[model samples]
Target chain A: MFIDGRALPAGTALEADIAIVGAGAAGITLARALKDSGLSVALIESGGLEWSEEAQDLAAGELGPQTYATPDTVRLRYFGGTTGHWGGWCRELDAIDFEPRDFVPLSGWPLKKAEIDPWYAKAQSVLQLGSPQRYADSEGIAKAAGAALPVARGGDIEPILFEFSPPTRMGEVYRAELEQSAVKTYLNTTLVDLRVGDDTRTVTTLTLARDGGPALAMTARHVVLATGALSNAQMLLAADSQVQGGLGNGADQVGRYFTDHPILIGYAAILALDPSAGGPFAFGDIAADKRRWRLAFQPSEAYRAAQKRLSCLITIEPPGPRFDPAAGAFDRSDAKWFGAPETVNALAAANATGPVRLHVLNAGIETRPNPDSRVTLTGKRDRFGMRRLKVDWRLSDADLEHYLLNLGDFAKALAHSGTALLRIPPDAAARWPEETSWGHHNLGTTRMGDDPRTSVCDRDGRVHGMANLWVAGSSLWTTPGAANPTLTIVALALRLADRLKAEMAA
Target chain B: MSDPVARAWAVTRRTFGATLLGALGLAAVETWPRWAFWRGAASSLDALAGLPQAAALKALGRQAQAAMAIPAGYADTLAARLGDEGYAGAVARDRAEGRLVSIDGWLVPETQALAGLWLASAG
Candidate 1:
């Protein structure tokens, strides 16, 4: 049942069979999965049922050389976490995402996509995305949507599908189940410190702080950190008093390899002759079976292998302003014409005799795992005296180059198919990060791997060298694919839930 | 030089000036199979010819020809048999075959880029 952690008297020592920290997508999934396992579970959340300004301010942190959404602004501190504002785009990671690619450094996960396929099926329902089977049946999905997949003839680029959620807000959808379950749910409780035994391997006690209440502690047979990517790293890196670098920092790997899918908003435009309105090839999202669907293009496996390019998901947007190069000399300033919608159609319209303008293209590209792009502690501290995080989210030069190359090839593939003409911005390279935005899907700080020297967690989500302590959420990702991360985050959480149940039973 | 294409080029240079003429004469001699399409007055083709993208468009046309394995004199064959509108049909065909090139960063069929080059030089 829900218990306001703040109402608990000073120095209350709560005990449970399992203590799960930060009740977001990952934590809530675990709590729900283990709700009836007969193990007493303590689910602690920093914010109460609603938004609180004080709680949100605790997430404020500094930025790096590149400009990013400030921590507090990009993330929600209350229940449901960032899902409270997510767009609900969901796609499973490609098989290649789990393999070690020679082109990508620190790439590949210890577990293959197949290892968690069952969990993904379960996660589909948990995410409110119907029928896990539909994701694999491409032709059926296209038939059901009543639209032909773009470039259906086949090329270096092929259409990939994304299933939309009613965007199941976990906090609200499961609030009743949580309330009815046997678990002890602590709201408005922030984990402050982790006390380890003399060996510094097992987390013995967890100290939590409430805004208006005195300090409280929780001891559990097993401890799980499911506080999203940035916060998981922040919490782990902050608990350095007992173990020097942090609880899982024996390899100095905690807070390293942070990543987000870098998106190119309006880098190119497409001109087609009277594109089918609301079709898969047309710009805009489509709906079928009471669910919204979006069709985006990705490089085929052959294309990536042959070109050594990174993965990217390219979507077409409706036509807007016309950047007419036909009217005058195509000057450098005309580069601004990109992202201008009507240019594609205007160009097509200008040709009067045939071919009409189509749409603009937006691409969200993947970045390689670079240790230099990481999260670190700043001297500034929050109200709880915990050092605020400094996010240094970096994208290497090759990352942008690879994305543009993949885009150019995709444009060629479209033309080859007699579908449309794509106009890539001439100055795309010059604009770099200035023209790029992020997925806001923070990932890969406490990555899972077999090597403690390189990763903070093992294949089972257990922090390296630490017993009975586990790290959850996207923070456990070894590589961030171009796919939006929530589905995978939930899938992995379910997988971990099964493992945790077995461990407790043993 | 007495060919109608030469006559059209004369009009084009006079209309748009010589500096922007670029390699129009050389491009025409090497790539244009038949210059009959230049029989009209200096049209919108003249404007495109004067743009900075004209050079790259010519180069892309040549690259497209090589990539698509189109005969060197195929342009003349199409123009001779199909007339001025033949290039547009060829662009559609080239697009269907996936024979494309990037000119000024705009992805266009190889035949389209070649036609742009031909028009720039044909006039």
Candidate 2:
């Protein structure tokens, strides 16, 4: 049953076996997964089924030192969360992403990729991916495209594939299911405080409010903070009434180590000897198995291990017009969408000499974990009387230096294969953090680990010292790999749902 | 030291003559793209071989060396290496050693960039 928080009386109180805050990808997935498990679930969202200006205003916060997408614009607060505008780019994290690397500090996840492989497989259906096998079939997809990726032997780069989703909008797709399910959906409700009992370990009650109304109360046997990476930490840090610092923030590790994939566009230009030379690099979409896939290149595992570099994926943009597979020609009508004008001009100038293809290269590289990159509570309060967030996103100088070195390695590999010659702009390194855009993937902050000092959650997604309080979503990620986080977010949510069922039974 | 002219020679006259005829023959069959690329490089070497000992070729060579800050006399060393290992071989070596520079937004092998700079200066 759906209940509008506005309709409830100011002093109303409710109870449930599980209370999930923020009905985004993680919250909805967890709520849906818990169905028929004999648990009475309550999903509390900060917005209505549809977006409104007033609800979006609640997402406003002070900007950080880095020029990032405004906090209000980065995430949505509605029923489906940010999946309302998601692009549906999905890929699982690499095995190395979960391992502890000697070169990277504050890295490694408490759970291994092998341990979460089943959840990722199950998440493929939730993400609307046609086939789970399609993601790993790079060779088959390349064969279907009639051109193999130009990966040279012993080269520092390897080809990878990204599968797309019709981008299942959870609110629109699962609205009827949610409406008919046993779970209670509360809209326009914001979690303001987490009240703990005398022990201060168990969260006995939750204070919620709606649109400047009087605070209401809800008690749950278990509480899962399914808010996004930014808000998860923001909500935890803002709940300082009970705990001195905040709930589960004894060591001051609640809002630190915030991370996102820093994107670099037009970082380098590629001049191919001919059109076929650039064909292997997914200048356009590769159609296979009646699904769309894109090919990109990343540093080989050996290369990263040897060079001590972070994860990065490089994509190529075709010059002139997009390639039309059916017509087997460039679609000039779509030329307006093409980026990298300099590459187009370069190719146009060289058109007479030969049929050369120019390509602009862009990269999405991981940021190293830094304690200074964090989210903290601001002095100002939102309409719900909860403190606003102040994000201070940062990237270390060493991370940027490693990214440039990785680009250099990719350039050499391309040249060595005689596929193309890559030219990195003179100011590529100096323009970082300013010229960089983002994947809009807010991650870490409430990172999971075995140690309480460094992480906010444990291996099973529970808070470090608190019982019955868990964190879900990208905020539990210890390291954000270069892949998009939505798939993993849902995967981890399903994993957390199983854990919750087991814990409840125990 | 060997004769400056011989050391600077990228292709011997006999090889250049044979390749020029071969390139013309292949052009009739529309298969001269590979040779056409090599012919341009060979022609640049031919021009460098004809210049004076203290010509602009040496100055352009120094410029290329300064971009990488390796050594001062790389022009002669690269010229000699280009003579010993053909155009493809020398370029492969430069790629292996990461000795390439971006000239006007084009990544050029150090040896090839020096030759192009010399040709531009000569013109």
Candidate 3:
């Protein structure tokens, strides 16, 4: 099961009623949901039981427009995929994201927020998080010397409501459950290509190559690709028989709409509420979303009104008497493992002479989607003999503009709220560091919509061209609201599971 | 209407709107970890090579983080070592100016490693 540098078990019987290409949050969640179905399932992963050097390499290097600047954000080849080391920040997509926002173009999900509300309720138990109802206890957190998030009133652009766990590591938390499954789990196996019936576009068989051997073929009644964003597109592009462009290449939409949360940090420092009073990006002053305790941001009323739509979270950390060793509050493992040293070096230099900034607040903003921002087949193969992905991440100028604008006002508010306002000089671009990469919430690649022409999948995560192929996870996100998207991804996966089950029964 | 604070507020509000508003409506375009391309392109032509896990996840360690929020005098050491690429010295500067002080709310379960500066370091 854990063989390396080669392909699948030699001459292995590769037949299953249902086949899932990844063993991540999406695949594992779905496999468990479909347990009793008469259909046998196959879950194939490129990596093995735990983290490995081989897997880490897939997460590194540059791929077209899809660049993995922060290798730490993903566990490229693992049993639970990247969920092997997730930060557990959970939140549901806003009602606005599900509904057609009057002002947002190419917005809206096939299903409504109400449809997934029940699913979110169920997912909470799986993630081992507290109930969503009592999530926000801002007053309680505020009483602490420094709570990082502020209390948020639901119903702005995103009426976000959900909670986070200390962070549910998929490998540590779900290994037992997976082992108990009757489902066949093929580790160290990568989906290299798809063979299609000449006339019909339906995928006839899945070809997998593990380590480095001749490809092995798999036949299945249905195929579900729960591969992370980059690999999902890579597999489709490599499936050359049915379509040269890729499996869901009808509109050439596989890698398009490449969007990452433009998380700007240190751009603004809330000047001086009381260094003692708790305001800004400090832990104590951080406003929670409804009942949740995490610090979050939304468009400033000014930006909201004009529709700049970008929002920033304020984290005013309590002047720590000492760092909480128990909480391990400061050891950002993901950052250390994946951060570009050159970039952080520049960021640190920019902040070399400031007050003890309480917390580093991130501004998670949505970027405009461009069809050109996409994944193309690089024709380069990994050790597994499959092609790599090319990432074209183009950000809009408008993003940088407002973060700076908000920075100025934020500093002013902090000053008025209390301190000697801190500011980044207007021309400090060169002095500033490379922007912060997102938290691996890869979204919008196979965006969902009513029309198949514009998007790759329908609202329920079913691929348009294929009857049995489905996708869940951030990839279906048309609008990744400012909230952390894992909870939403889980919600969508649950929704898809329920739909699939119901349809199977019908 | 002519009060200095009010004047400052008005000018400040307009400037904020001017710069950050027009770009509203759009959201999250570039992706996180968008690295599949160059590696794939290289591999496509039979040129892809693997890197070490320690190097693959080199960013996941504490040394870099410890170095990120060095005390005022610490950066000068690396400053000489990294002449052109020396960190703009943001940590040292932010510390001296009280800018990096107690960022109370800007934390997640684990962000200390990123900045290292805490309340004791605050003014």
Candidate 4:
């Protein structure tokens, strides 16, 4: 049963097999997966079903130091978590995302892409995305985008597609299943503390609050935190009783290794191919990988490297006389002409046509993993008196260097391929000398790895020090790649659920 | 529960007055996307009713975009960086920010503007 954060029940303690916190993408996915099982689960969320201004504001970068999904970015803080506001783009973590890179320090996942492949298929089925397990579908997508994308010899590229589900709301999707289960969802019952034993070995109980009421202590055999990247480590460090620094903080790595795919509107232009919109193209088209998807682009090696993902979307050109959809230029969409996306589109169009007949889509660059810029709990408490998260987030210099290098190098490659042109390459170069940053994708606080010393959680997401505790969501992403991370988060939660189920069975 | 000090100082009244305009603005925004579509649909329907032939589309486009405007969020964020004030200003700034392609002027901007005009005209 759900409880309000401001109103506490008369009871002193509640018991459950699994005490899960924050029903975002990670929490909700795991909860739903474990719903049918008879094991008791108490799913807690700080926000109610609908939009709350306070909760939304808390998600914003302007209000908080950590910013992935802001008030404007997501309709978060509900049962479904952040999925309500997702654009429905789904892709598996690249096989390379698991490997350690000599170039990128502190990069690599202990688990590999092979282990995740089965999970990806399961995730695809759950998301109801079309099949993407084959190359024929990818070829179909390449054809859909038009004949410009060069077919590779090595089969080096992975074809990832966007799935627009009836907007997967984690809460609503799992609501019916959860109602009949042993799992009890506690909405507005915020977790205040994750107390551990005297030896800081196991999680004893979680101190939770119902809005303005006195805290309730709940004991559980296991506890998992899926409260996003910023909030995950925030809660860990806030549990001051167990360790001086935080839970699973034996290495003082509670809030280190933060990374995100920082996006930039790179060179954009007018394609020479006139757009015939009605024929074979729609923003919502189907690709062969059993995934219904849209236009795709090949990100650069420097950009789409291990732990780095750059999802470059090539949108339909703006419907105008001189716009060329085939050449990656000339968009008449509002993005090019009206709002922010439109404005960027317009910039691309102008750059692609006239004296310069080329527009390159924005490069969504991934940053180097930096352990210094991270999140921690400030002594100051939130509505629950749990230490509110104090986040210090920033893009690193390596991020900028690679961003520029990849952009330049890719522009050169496209020019060499005779598939692209830079209207004013020198000008594009000049403008990039000064660095600017934006916050949308926050990642890597409680990063995942086998070693307890460097990472907060084990490969399966169990907290290193506490066997019963696990970290979920983007917080567990040791390094974020170039794609939007929502899909990856869902995939990770699904994996964690299997482990949880097996453990309970044992 | 009203705070005694705030009540005594008439803060509630003042705060309410201050937010009155913002509330209206939000209401306008909430309805704008739908409104745009509504006007667009109405114009197209009217065109089909009035002139079922050549210019039905052309007529519909104009009606929808009669009051077409960009959201203030863009103006506050990307536009300011690019040096734009409003919708037209934002587009103009966006075009200006790009490297000059036309020997004298960029043709794509005009084409984009025409497209916007078309989308708006359908209203």
Candidate 5:
């Protein structure tokens, strides 16, 4: 049943066995998993089934140093969460990402990749992506495309694969399923505060409100915080009536170690292959099994281990219409070749005939978790009187060093193979790009770990020292990997659901 | 004749001469492209011997004319050399100037060089 919080009377109190805040990808996946499990579930969302400006303003926050998408614009406040605009690129984190590395500070996950492989399979189905076997069998793509990825193994670089989704929007994809289930969804209800007991360990009541409506309260045996990375920390920091700093923030680790994948245009090169030979290098056709895949390049695990560098993935893009001379109107006589006119003329003549294929290189670099890069509370409050967030996202010199070194290695590998000649201006490698871009993947604010002193939540996604409070989102990530986080986010949510089910049965 | 001052002066002069020759040798290696430009251009035609297409030779000629700032008739001589045994030498000149590079049997201009040509053609 869908309940409009606007229609509720003042002081209305709802009861359920499980009360989940934020009806996004994680919330919806958990609700679906708990359906018909003999437990009553209340899934609450801040917005209606669609977009609302008033609801989005609740996410407004200050960007401290870097230029980043505002919290309000980077994420959607609707039922589906940020998946509403996601590109649906999905890849599982490599085993190396979960291991404790000597070079990477604050790296390592409490759980191994094997522990979550089963949930990843289930997540594949929920995402409407094809079978996991398809990703395991790369030869299928080579057979279907009739050409292999021009990359070879046993070198400094290796090819990695990514699968695309119909870019599944959970609200649209699972709306009917949610309506048919026993989970009761309350739309336009915002989580205002969490009333904890005197011990500061157990949450007793949750205060909720809607625009132009009376405030309501909810009581539950178990509460799950599925709000995204930014809001999850914001909610925890704001719910500080019982604790001095915030609930589950005794170690001051609640909002620290914030991270995002820093992206930039790495290099440019021409594939020595003829235009006809470019077909195999392009995004592979959706196989007969309805799975579309693309290949990217990354340094091998051995190389990374030897170099002690963070993981990064290089994406190749074909030259678009921007390369067409007819489309571009520019003066050649005034063209400066950096003192190489013969080379310039030869390049123009080659481009006019379109004999060789051009490729642009872009990469996503993993920024190490830093205690200084964090989210803290601002003096100003939101519509519900909760303190707003102030985000200080930063990147270290190590991050820049890892990106440039790996790119240099990749360029050399291409040149050595006689496949292409890579060109990156010397200055570009000396410093980070002036304007850094990100995929809006917020992570690590409420990271998980075995030790309560280092992480906000335990390995099972439970808040430290709290029996019934848990977090479910990318916020629970121990370390952000090079791959997109949606697949892992959904997988972790499903794993949390199973734990909740087993606990309830016990 | 056995004075220590005269003996020291002779040793110093020999050491200085050897150091100067070593420095010159290193400089030549570093600045080979600039110093060898004429020799490399004269031999550029050798680099194109492997190319099978006459049109490819003509294209190289045109690029050479524009790059060398020579008249149209001079371009024909460069183009003929491009199709002869000296094609490799001609290509060496272009490569030294950052004009041409070979990839998978096809000789093409570097991306920067192409951009320059495109701009010139647009004008």
Candidate 6:
């Protein structure tokens, strides 16, 4: 049942077996998983069914010194959450991402990759990604098309694949299923304060507010804060009645170690090849039983471990005529190409007989977690009277070092393979592209770990001191890999659902 | 006939004439393969020589060489001061700074003189 919070009577009190704050991807997934478990669940969302300007204003926050897309603009506050605009690029986090690396400070996950592999397969079905098979392992596509990836297996670089969704918006995709479920969804209901008991170990009740309405209270056996990394940290930091900092923040690590994938664009090369004879780096499409797959490149696990580098993915796109030197000299101010004669000649020759078969490179790099990068509460209040978030997103020098070193390795590999001659400006490592961009992957604010000092939540998504309070979302991620986080977020939510169900059943 | 300046002029002219002839012979020998290749692709040497496309291509080649030109003896100095890696690094830095222009067919600093040397060894 879906209830509009504005229509409720003033000072209403609600009760439930579980109360989930924020009906986004993680919240919705968890709610769906607990649908028929005989547990009365309250799925509370701040926004209405559709987009509203008032609700978006709540996301307005201050940004730190580093440049970023405004928090309000990058994130949406409607029922489905950011999945409403998500590109649906999905891949499982690599095995190494879960391991404790000696070089990376505070880098291991309490849960192993093997523990989550099953959940990933289940999540694949939830996201509608057909199978878990690697795109390169798809038989005959590479051999028949002659578009094999040049990077050798067990080498410095290897082929990786990202399965695209109809880029499923969770609200749209699961609305009908949710409508039939027993869970109660309250829209336009904002979680205002977490009322902790006198002992200060457990949350007794949650205060909620609505636009132009009296406050509401919800008491639940279990409370899951599935609000995104930013909002989750904001709320925890704001609920400072019992604890000076916030609930479950004894060590004051609620919002520290925030991380995002920092993307750099200028480091690129154009590979010239015959139109008839396809290049190894070109995007390959394969139709398997019912799924469509696209191929990409990533460094092998051994390579990343040996080099002590973060995960990175490279994409190949067809070069445009504008990038062709023979077309005419481009203004250095506008063009990304280096305008090398050999490159132009190669492009011209490739286009001489038929279509141009040149490939351009783009990469997405992973950022190592830094403790100083975090989300804090600002003095400014939103319409619902909750303090807004202040994001201090940061990227370390190691992140840039990994990006350049891997890019240099990619160039050397291309040159050695005789696939194409790659010329990298020697000091390309020293200079970064002016416009550094990122995917809207908010992660690591309330990371999961066994140690209470470093992480906000335990491996089961429960807060350390509080037995019933939990967090479910990318916020629980210990480390954000280069791959998109939606599939893993859903997988972790489903895993949490099982634990929650068992606990409720008990 | 007995004047020393006149004798010197005569000797210089003779030596200059011999050097010019020898250089022309070497150039012809070096370019023979390229000429032959073009001849085979085209109908004949005369047919290829007079075509506007041939002239435009030659002009384009010259333009490419000009774009890749560097200072006199700069390559030797660079090669000496910087090893191969350092030289490549310097060249890359220069190109990035817009101090060097890159031609499509040739590497940076590929002058017309280098083209001649490459052609001589092409056979």
Q: How accurate is candidate 4 locally (lDDT)?
A: 0.58
CAPRI rating of model 5: incorrect
lDDT per residue, candidate 4, A58-136, as tens digits?
Answer: 4443233434434235336666777776667565556666678777788889888788777777776566565546322
lDDT of 6 by residue, A139-225 (tens): 344554556656555468766677787778888888878777899999999998999888887788999999878899999989999
lDDT by residue for model 5 (A1-506), tens: 88899898887879989998998889999999998788999999998899989889998989977877788988899889888999888888877888788888888899898898999999998898877656544556656756555557567887767888888999999999898889999999999898888777888898998887767889998999998999999988888878888888999999888888887753334444334446545543434445677677788778888888889988876555544567672134222211134544555455556555445566788878787889999999887887888888888878878877887677656544434545554345444544568878988899999988889999899999888899999998877879889999899999999999998888
Quote the lDDT for B31 in model 3. Answer: 19
The sequence of per-residue lDDT tens digits that candidate 2 reaches over residues A1-506 is: 78898889777879999999999999999999997799999999989999998888888898787999888999998999999999888889888888888988989999899999999999999988877666656777888877666664346787778888888999888888888999999998888899888888898898888875677899999999998998999888887887888988999998899988988876676656434664675457777877778887888767788878898988877654433233344333322122234333323344323445556777888878888899998889887778898889988778778877887777767766656767776666777778778998999889999999999999988998898899999999898878899999999999999999999999
Task: Please report, as a residue range, the 10-residue window in candidate 2 chain A with the lowest summed lDDT.
Answer: A334-343
Writing each residue's lDDT as its tens digit, candidate 1 over A1-506 gives 99998898887879988999988889999999999999999999888888889889888898898877888887887777777788888889988888888988889999998998999999998999987666545556677778766576346887777889989888899999999999888999999888999988888999898878777888888999998888899999999898888888988899999988887877776655333433555446667767777778888867787788899999886543332335543223333533232332233334332324345677888889988889999999988888899999998889989888888887787776655657777777887887678888898999999888889999989998888999889998888878999999999999999999999889
- Report the number of clashing residue pairs per model: 13, 0, 142, 58, 23, 3
Model 4 TM:
0.68
Error of 3 at A69 (Å): 1.4
Question: Best by lDDT, which number?
Answer: 2
Count of backbone collisions in candidate 3:
142
lDDT of each: 0.77, 0.78, 0.55, 0.58, 0.74, 0.72
How closely does chain A match the true chain A in each prediction, as TM-score?
0.93, 0.93, 0.80, 0.81, 0.94, 0.93
Could you give the candidate ranking by lDDT, starting with the highest?
Answer: 2, 1, 5, 6, 4, 3
Please list the residue runs of candidate 6 whose C-alpha ends up more than 4 Å from where it truly belongs after superposition: A135-146, A274-281, A284-289, A320-334, A339-358, A430-434, B1-123
Compute each candidate's TM-score over C-alphas.
0.83, 0.83, 0.67, 0.68, 0.80, 0.79
Give the distance in Å from residue A467's predicted Cα in candidate 6 to where it truly belongs: 1.3
Error of 4 at B106 (Å): 15
